[model samples]
Target chain A: MLGDEAEAEDVLQETFLSAFKSIDSFEGRASLSTWLHRIATNAALMRLRKRQPLSFSVDEVTEPGNGNLIPKVFYDWCCLPESELMTQEVRDEMRAAVENLPDTLRVVFLMRDVEGFSTQETADILDLSLSAVKSRLMRARMALRERLSAYFGGAASADMEGTRYE
Target chain B: MSEKHAHRDCSHLLAGLSAYIDGEAEAALCAEIEQHLAACENCRVVVDTLRRTVLLYREEQPAPLPEGGEAAPVQSVRTG
Candidate 1:
């Protein structure tokens, strides 16, 4: 649900109207939720495009009074909790990292990783090829691993201390 | 095991292991993976880490569901 009350109402109304309008083409292949999310995403994207926000690239950073600028750290992989093997902080970091993913990657990751949708379901929902879905997921995971390695140390070493990695 | 033998070259199945753990892998591949895991310590570690990661990934039982209480405009929540 959109947090803004007015926005939520408008979304609800528009969604119903669209559904009614397209009732003839309603195929039962996808779940209602997936269809709704697709509609919502489209609506939301349009709104964001119209009301542009100030752009801030991750690379650019500013320092306070001293004038010595500090570079922003872009490594975000460690934020994802690897497997029930990490501490809460690590898990939270993982969530943040996932959240920070670009819009496309974020959607793909969420549909597959978070929502428990199969690769087929995800590809169908996103209108991406199966290979594209797999590749994107792999890339997203690799990016997370790379970032984790940067922040926490070697990818293989960071998670394995007392424990072992095969 | 020799250094060459110490690392069980299990990265090939690291991803598969996740599926295997979830009982989603093909039966033959599952058996093969388990066989590999049984003999190789290095590969075993990889499996252990990956398994642990998967557990962490799905840590919550019955994860929180969105109530849709915040009702907002459809056209406003940007996807792109």
Candidate 2:
């Protein structure tokens, strides 16, 4: 999420140190990984806030379908073959698409969709409400869909043999 | 249908789409969205690509785990 390799490593080291110092606070209610994940997320967010505080604020969560995220690119790229979609170039594009998301949406999308966390888990990790998680996730997915559409929109057709998204 | 209920509008249906794909949506809302998708080609493409986008990202390689070390203890990720 920080989008810098050195900074990401710094956050990782910081996460372990924090966990060590606060070991007594480990309630063990959630998995160790989840707890660590939360620490890591907060650490990353802290760095993000330090860099561009105004852009990282989650004070005003946007409502779903509020017109800010209206789908502009309606091309259906899901018909592309798996080999075509999973190419290194496409993967790089995928990573860039995610990296380009706003901080709030990017964090929610990573925890919920990328990490397989339940929406509630994501809310708890981010200190957001369940509804907030849902709305943010909805916006994040739509934004990514638009980005990917630019790449795969006209590359193939639904009639292509061995369609995987069917 | 009431004039106040423009729920069929593409933007309105966009709100419930993630829930619909995630199976977190109520059945009635799901029906409403699917109904809209059948008639709106753009919405159909949006929903399909949205679902696919989520799926694609879900398969992303996991982030690296923190390696354990007993080096000088410092600070945790969060702060006051």
Candidate 3:
């Protein structure tokens, strides 16, 4: 989740050092891995706060039950050849698309998808409700899907999307 | 894509899409989504591409190195 290579390197040391300093405080309520991840997440958040205004809070005001995040891209872009799918250019775009997500959704996406945390684990770690984690993850996926569609299907998706509604 | 189901509410189904994709949705939900997919071309495409999107990210993850601290030795193929 930090997204910067140098920052990640620096944060790794910081997280370990912080964890080392706080080792005695460990209550063992959560798994050792989860505890370490919590520390690392805090370190990342501190770095983010120093870099720029933080975009989200842990208790971000919830949106509507069905927030306006409907899938807008209708084209089937999955048929792209495997060779084209993971090409360097495509990979870069994928990474960029992830970076573009709002911090709230991006963090959840990373914790769940990239960090390999279960949805319940992510919610427990972040102190978010289960539903919040689920909704944020879905929004993140849908947003990335739309961004990626622009590349695989390009303008054709817009045309395909035209007939979506009644 | 049919006119008969054109105005049907697809929003509620959206909430369940991720659960459906993750194989965590209830059997009733799975059945509902499948039945919806049969008639909804747009939803079918969304589900397929959404699944592809998740797979692409998971696939992009680098493979873990071998368990040893250092390089694992490969046996020499050439006979002396």
CAPRI grade, predicted model 3: acceptable
List ranges where model 3 is wrong by over 4 Å. Answer: A49-54, A57-61, A65-68, A155-166, B2-8, B62-80
**Clashes in model 2: which pairs?**
A18-B76
The positional error of residue A136 in candidate 1, measured at the CA in angstroms, is 4.2
| TM-score for chain B of all predictions | 0.56, 0.67, 0.67
Q: Which numbered prediction scores highest in TM-score against the true structure?
A: 2
Q: Residue-pair clashes per candidate, as listed?
A: 26, 1, 0
Q: Model 1, B37: alpha-carbon shift in Å? A: 1.7
* Model 1 Cα lDDT, one tens digit per residue, A38-122: 6765665445444433322222122122111111222223244435226565666666666565555556666676667788877
Report the CA-based lDDT of candidate 2 relative to the real structure.
0.79
lDDT of candidate 2 over A69-153, digit per residue (tens): 6777666778778988888888899999989989888988988887889988898888889988998888888888888997675
lDDT of 3 by residue, A23-138 (tens): 99999999999998888887887777777665766545376565545766676878878987888888888999999988778889888877889998898887788989998998
Q: Report the C-alpha lDDT of model 2 over B1-80, residue by residue, as the tens digit.
A: 33243334667678788899999899899999888877777778788898899888877676455454223234333342
Query: What is the Å distance of residue B67 in model 1 from its true position?
Result: 12
